[model samples]
Target chain A: MIVAEQKPIDEIKKMVAPYQKLLILGCGTCVKTCFAGGEDEVAVLASALRLSFKKDGKKIEIEEKTIERQCENEFIQEAASCVARNQAVLSLGCGAGVQDIARQFAKVPVLPGLNTTFIGVQERPGLFTEECVGCGNCELALYGGICPITRCSKKLLNGPCGGSQNGICEVDPSVECAWQLIIDRLKTLGQLDNIRAYIPPKDWRSSNSGGPRKLVREDHII
Target chain B: MKTSPSNLQKTLENGKFAVTAECGPPRGANVKVVRQKAELLKGVVDAVNVTDNQTAIVRMSSIAASAHLVQMGLEPVMQMVVRDRNRIALQSDILGAWSLGIKNILCLSGDHQTFGSQPDAMNVFDIDSMNLLRMVKNMRDNGKDMSGFELNEAPQMFIGAAANPFADPFEYRVIRLAKKIEAGADFIQTQCIYNMKRFKEWIRLSREEGLTEKVYILAGVTPLKSAGMAKFMNNRVAGMDVPEDVIKRMEGVPKEKAVAEGLKICLETIAELREIKGISGVHIMAIEWEEKVAEIVKAAGLQK
Candidate 1:
């Protein structure tokens, strides 16, 4: 799922400063699971902002709302009334969700409250690490399910760039060397020869290099 | 079949022990220092390597510096790394370097950006060193650009890549070198050698695989300035191996004569490397001590 983290409270406060009435809009799907822009997060931010404004002797009206999902038009329509009453919205959603809400509600100024990080998997209960870069071309089969493009700091297709030490990357000791992981996994799978096969330079057009990508299923289209 | 001949290429092809040196362009547009460094190595060395934003520190472009070296009648081995430019910039620069009469290029995946002054800067490793070598080779062999467009005139360049014998998973280093050679690397310049025992092991592995016969391998050697510098490189520099004995040799010396002792160590290493069967030559990297390069090269009997 997409993972994101909330911006600093000071930055969020500044973004909401000009508006007399603000809506803290949250998404209930991916962002919710990541704890960035969820219903509970929205309430906490709303209460914090109310107290901050109160101490400053400002009478700013704060409203909170959480939609099932911010990316879908059907779910976005559910927040129309709350959005109509607010002067601006502090979108507690991923970048896609914020952009979607802004696209639907053209008049209201939508400010992003969360910094959308990456497409990641939860490594532990509270730790999420990026697992995919959505390069549009998947080559996980070659690397024993390890995504070198995303996990490797250098994005080296033919790597472990002389800095892999005891499975730790030279860039950071905390980060595991992606190539080391791939070699280890491959050894376990009896495909160690895969490392010997020279993977040529990747054709990057499938990724973001070609610009914004979209998909259409003609058969399923209404 | 060679369209153009580079002195270093000719030297290696002739089976002579080649000698190359590095010249760092000034952080600002001070071409005087660049010229001085090149001048110091003028006839003593076969070619001078102009580093490209080495250590991610913003410096004058290696291309421009190499151009200046060309004007000085010196062979400039322009070093291009993947840290700064995407494929477009890289290909464009290769053509530009060729137009300026630069015949050699060393492809490397440069140091990470965090070590530089601009730590927050975004790095664009659009291609790694291996791919860069292949792309350059493609341009030369196919007479076409990376985009598959035909070129009216393609650059004939002597390609080079980097290797580190001291880095971890030590057995795999030779395989990586083989991969780079297969990817069209014409020459290989290793990282600075301090742990000769470990480096010998790597060289032996390369010999067993017959990699040395395929590509010219120039061992990288840096004359240490002081014991402090030796410790810093061992502890702080990634993938560098500075054995305790080498550090002790420097630390054992008095502070006043440490630099001279350092040069002696480099000379001994060169003498030893020449005796190795697969070793082709030496690339002396006297960082910040470019003035000492001529003395070391002459002492090593490379000044012909």
Candidate 2:
């Protein structure tokens, strides 16, 4: 899913002011399911911009496009046919989708209408919270089923920070302590002793910390 | 329709006894039904509300129909749902109504489409109704949107939000109503009420919990047309409670007298609410029974 967040409407309005013709692009993947940058959002944003401009007595043309998937280059072509005389493209997709579109047409400015939020899953209806960070390393086997990278403030590889009071994160009190979650999961799995074993320090260099990460597979290669 | 700005304030200061009415849009595009109902209460009602998909069922747009009410010399409170649109659409409709010079707006989270015509329709609840109210107030008061960003010029409108009187336990419902008032609601139009004693007790808690000074509380009175329909509301609609006594009253009345008896019950409820401290007005949700709205208001002896 293309994870995304929404920016302030005025900021977006200011960014698209000069361009009378614009495309409001929406992604139908992750952000769509999360109710962030979706087809309905694209229509609404387009309509809002139309109204905002009308309030100032300035009229503009807004074209809406909903691509099947925006994070991939293969799906980026869906927007190419619609980018005519449009000086600015308001991408309602996630960061990856925006980057893919921007890179394809380097001359035109691709502005994100959404703020990319996080890698996560929908726990229930009308709610979503971060649950994972793709560190190119699988460490859940060591820490139960919880991801320390995203949930834990320090990404503590070996232990919890001393500031975890009442089993809540010190960084943001709303966040559940990662170690606390790991301990709860272990208790559920009847393996609380797993926390007593020796755990190796996480090498930050091997994860997202060092640089932009990539992958290549021979079986998927054409 | 003729209440001057000063007169409205004087009424509020004198606290003029008021009666509000609800007129739901038809389940389809047929305007004849709603138009006929509007004609029935063209003069005797305070305001005719245009509900936007009351049960989340698709109908003629509320704004267009409310515009019709305004043309018919009735003040139309346009009901908007945050569950159907994002902050973007919510603001757009608000501005659209403002540009048309429509001032009174009723903000709602709306019935989730799961409870409406299409259960599988994708619901866009990126914003709640409270945030929607804040957005409208932002345009007028802070000259900003829901995100604390500036607007070109704010729309000055009287904003209203919903509260469920019979939804949760008495204390929880009162606390939530208090919270809604604190969020800058000019007035509150609540869910249906059958037991005025329970409603009176709920209003009593509002007094004990300090909710009166903030805003006006408009008690909702939905006049029942049939006992079967009353049972349908209590069973299917979440947060709606029609007491068994009201059901028995509905069953005891003959087909011809049921509607009149229902109107009497609503008038009595409104009169009872007026006795309680801090109860401001009555929002009559007569539904398809909009013809009886005038009768109820007249029977309750509310303001013209």
Candidate 3:
């Protein structure tokens, strides 16, 4: 799931100030679940902007269309036909939705209505926390099921840093030590001795921190 | 023609047995959905109230829907919720609705963000529902805004609010209603009522406590169509209490008979509400069940 947060109303208002015919698109997927760009928020924001535009003696046609999902091309098309007349689309979806809409519309400017935060799950109803990062490689088997790239304070692969104390990382004591989890999982499987094996240093050259990343599968692409 | 304030006052004074119905706007831009509901209930009910985003789902604007209702020759009561809007937007919408000659209004704070498909939403209860009531009254009476600042023309509206019983303590609910009444609420449309015994008792108590004379009260009713609907009302809706006997009746009957039973129960409740001395009206909430409303009213022995 893509975690997202609502941009403050003022910030979004400024973002779409130049557009007269505004089309507020609501996504029913991630942004809706996160309460950022859902059906309700889109209506509220539209009403607010409508009144604001009215007070300025400006007649702006701010329409609302809530698609079931904004990430997919098919669902985004549900909003496309009606949006051509509008000057800009104020997307109440995730960052992916804004980009996807922009890709589809091409001519019309698509502004984000929510700040994409993370990819996470519903820990419980009404609450969501950071979960997966979707890093290019998966090393979960070597360190239990818990992802070190997303959860660890230090993305240690070879060994646990010497600074760990009480199963907490030294960088932030509140964060659990990823190495400790790996150790526990290993002990459970009677493979604690694997820690003695020398592992190569992680190459950061291919990671997102260097620059943009792309994936291409020969089987899927012609 | 614009009716004089005194004429409105006199009409409202003798407005006993007033019947109201609700129409929710469509989620899409097409006005047909709302217009269809308004036209179906028009002339049959005294006033038609348009709801703003019930259940926090996206919909067309209630004000625009009210405009359509007004065009259809129905007295439109525009519902405004402050939960989404700041004071500026709320005040402007009220004035705009009034300028459009749509006078009656229902001021609601609306559903919280947590209840909707959306969570983590920012609730600007900057001004609660009561304060909006005071603001509207102050704007018209004192010719000033909420901050005592002057405006060129203040909108005069027939103010109304909602009351929920059977959720919290009944006395507290009554007290809350009394507070809204004290804050210049001219009328009240209550939450859904399925049991007349509890409703009549509440009305009797309110009359005893001097609530009946101060403001008009309209009991809200919505028919429970199926056993699933009854279950949803009982569990999902916080204040609405659909009685087990009614559910049992619906369950035991055939599918066709069950709808008739539901309509019959609603008519009985409405007839009972009409007989209550202090009750002024009934607000029928036949949401998607608009077609069954006329039948229900006729069965209730009310003039349409």
The root-mean-square deviation over C-alpha atoms between each candidate and the true structure, in angstroms, is 1.7, 18.2, 22.7
Whichever of 1 and 2 has more lDDT, that candidate is 1
lDDT of 3 by residue, B31-90 (tens): 888778877887677787888877667788888888888787778778888667777788
DockQ of each: 0.63, 0.02, 0.01
CA shift at B104, candidate 2, in angstroms?
0.9
Q: Worst 10-residue stretch by lDDT in candidate 3 chain B?
A: B1-10
Which residue pairs does candidate 3 place in steric collision?
A: none
* Stretches of candidate 1 exceeding 4 Å from the true structure: B1-3
lDDT of 1 by residue, B100-201 (tens): 999999999888898789999998877888889899999998989988999888999999999998886777788899999998899989899999999999
Ranking of models by DockQ: 1, 2, 3
| Model 2: per-residue Cα lDDT over B153-217, one tens digit each | 67776778787766533434564565456555788887788977677788887888778767777
Error of 3 at B179 (Å): 0.4
Chain A in model 1: its TM-score?
0.97
Runs with alpha carbons beyond 4 Å of true place in candidate 3: A1-222, B1-11
Candidate 1 docking DockQ: 0.63
Clashing pairs in 1: none
